[model samples]
Target chain A: MSRASWQAFREGAYHTLPLILGAIPFGIIFGTLGPASGLSVEATLLMSLLVFAGSAQFIALGLVATGTPVGLIIAVTFVVNLRHLLYSITLMPSVCHLPLNWRLTMAFWLTDETFAVAVSRMAPEHRTQFHWYYLGSALAMYGNWQLCTLLGVTAGQWIPGIENWGLDVAMAVTFIGIVVPQIKTRPKLLCAISACCLSLLWHDWPHHTGLIAAAIAAVVLALTAETMGQKKETSLKTGSKTT
Target chain B: MTEFILIVGMLAATYFVRLLPFALADRMRLPAILENALQYVPIAVLSAIIAPAVCLPEGYFWIDWKNPYLMAGLVSVIAAAIGRNLVITIFAGMATALSIKFLIV
Candidate 1:
């Protein structure tokens, strides 16, 4: 890679350093639970490497523990990860300048945490080299996931019930940090509030469909709020002009 | 064999969902309304994701006097809202939750 690309990559990785804390317990929990659920270490690692979706992986682990059919497990995971589609959509415009191969690799690596970091760092001056930064964050997250999962699979045996130690609560809190700064508008706040309430209400929904429902509700609500605000502005202007 | 199939299928489906629209982003002209709504996607999905993690840490819904998640999460959210600091929010949240869990369980 060029020196510029290399620098961008390092910057990306460095910025992602703090977010890695949130992913650590999550990856370790998945690692520990995978083996405990009767999955072989190899299969667990393969799933973490290839699938790389924590929510879906955890859901799969639960289903596997219950002896749910493989087909059903995949189906459930598909539904659970449909939110990634929204993620992809949100990231598209920012990533559209890259080559096809780079885009493909990025799409594969773009998780919630990486997306948060990458999007925030995409200032106008950095647009040309941002792909390098994206790669940096993506690879850092990938490496962390792999190493943490390995630790969980191997050393996790010595630490009994470590998955339940509430360490993963840090991830939820980190998520709040990611959301809090972006909520400058009333509609955005309401979007978060409504999504939070709906997700709780739909927590028990089958196959993680409730998450999608809540996300869709927030998007729709935000759209309505923005459009209505626009219309009201226009109507007030016309009314004053007529008066 | 079943696990293999599960992994492969999920890999294919998940990757497809991620790769397709991204590839199509340049070629497509999304409607303005859809574009506007996309702005809310990340925070909405994130907020939604957070709800279950705190409210149903054990994969079941429970929010009451006994659960530390709700209380701890509220603490973390307040910290995030006030401090806007990732490290502080995570550490404070985890510390609060762990302390409560330690005290209770």
Candidate 2:
């Protein structure tokens, strides 16, 4: 590869290294849990390949293991992943100039980690290279995930103290790392608090439907708060002008 | 046969959900209300996952003060809020939880 391409790859790898580290334990947990939940080796690997989502896949496995209806499992997965819609929207302008093939390829790898890193680095002027950087980050993450899962599946049975590793805490820590930085406004804070409360209250709902309810509640609360804030701003401006 | 059918149906449904937004996003101009709603989707979904995991570790409404996950999560939050590196936050939280779990649980 040319020096520029190699540099791009190195930069992308450096940017995404933290995400890969965080994802390792997550991938191991999923790999171990998949087989323990009655999924065959093929099925477990296929899930990592197709679904490619850590939390959603775990929820789906639980539902499937519990013999929840297939329809419900699919629906819940869709709801849980609805945030990807927002990611795509935010990324659309940056990626619109790419060819359809490249766009589609990049879309397949747009996980939460890639989205966080890519969005933070995206510049309005250098929109074109955003896809290249995105692809590089995605490739690194995807490669690491596959390797980690392979190790987890092969040695998972004999890994005596794997469960004691506290890898599960990584997910929560990663989310806190991402979310706390973005909670700079009152509306965002309200939305987060409201969603957490609603989720806890509705935790007993079947088929993981409580998550959907929480998401809807947060969206409604945030939108209402934003609308009210805008109206108050307008009223203040009008009153000041009249005075 | 049933399992195969279910898997196929799920794959199709998932693809459809993913494709629907991309297909319609260009053709249909989303209204202001809908735009506003989309803004909270991430926080909402994240809270849905995190809150339950922390608040209900025993798979019920039982709250335990000695819960390592909860304590570690709180630490992680504080660390993140202070703008610590992501790796450091995760390591601190995970190590704390593992030590607590081993010592206590």
Candidate 3:
């Protein structure tokens, strides 16, 4: 509510614009596909409103179309979203000091885009009001999602072949932009490379289990590299001291 | 009614996983090694997601050099490495991908 909070909120939303743009194509496509997949219009919109997770929603849509059991759909959604658990843990330190209500609200809105934007912006300088900025990013993404679903469900019929436009490339490139800059160390570079290779090799795994597997493996590899590097440095120091 | 149940089930499943850690944040004390791993989570996860999006654009491996998505992804990487601007990197990649899709191959 303070001017500073409002400014942080706006800045958060501003930084997330490219990501927001990236989601438009996917949003509209989800909207159109919901009905085509035999989901009632109300149910599709409700899923977007309540679940608010893009990947899970898409996977669920595929299952629903195949007439998969509801229990199976729910289980797959949980599995696919397990990656968010890691995200929640990673971000816990930053939000632990905030009130429970704020944390809960943020947890609900923690999509990939919002997480990417919020984590980068959660610098010490903005420590006090970073939640406001996060709220801004989350709310902006939420609003855009709803609007895109509306466009897809209602107006999507009028625009043919929107899915083939390859607009989803926007998201892929945006992610590259976000991740490449973060690769400042050799360990991180290897961690990312391992993740990429593992995910590709395991791409066909059901329920996006591959993504979670690849991420965990990559993290473990990076930790090993870091620990080895530290040990080498310490050993060298001890040897020089003896010399 | 089944659809309603399905929706509620999904909402519960999705929200619970995301909320559990935050709810326990105060009590959760991660080990130093795990904390160190957390730093790599973002890059690893994003890279994991990006690989399939580019190479498996058609839901199967298509790792050709001429794959437009691959080409555009490389451009975005270079742009980010050189420019370090999110907006510029996205624009450069999008322009490359779209032009190749619409104009060339």
Give the winner by lDDT. Answer: 3
Per-prediction interface RMSD in Å:
1.3, 2.9, 1.1
TM-score of chain A of each: 0.93, 0.82, 0.95
What residue pairs clash in candidate 1, if any at all? none
Residues A60-115, candidate 3: write the lDDT tens digits: 99999999999999999999899899988988778878889988898999899998
- Model 1 lDDT per residue over A113-189, tens place: 88888877656798888899999999999999999999999888789999878787878888887898889998898
Per-residue lDDT for B33-59 in model 3, tens only? 677688898998999999899988889
Candidate 2's TM-score: 0.84
Candidate 2 lDDT, B1-105, residue by residue in tens: 444545555555454544444444445566656655655666766776777777776677646657777888788788877866788787777777787788877
Q: Which pairs clash in the backbone of model 2?
A: none
Arrange candidates by DockQ, descending: 3, 1, 2
List DockQ, one per candidate, in order.
Answer: 0.76, 0.49, 0.81
Q: Can you give the TM-score per candidate against the true fold?
A: 0.94, 0.84, 0.95
Model 3, runs deviating above 4 Å: A123-125
Score chain B of candidate 3 by TM-score. 0.91
Instruction: Give the per-residue lDDT digits (tens) of candidate 2, residues A1-243.
Output: 656656666777788888788788878877777777777777777767766666677787788788888787778777666666667765665665666666667666767788777776657765646666777898988888887777777787688668556677777777667776777788888888898899899988865678678867887888889889999999999999999
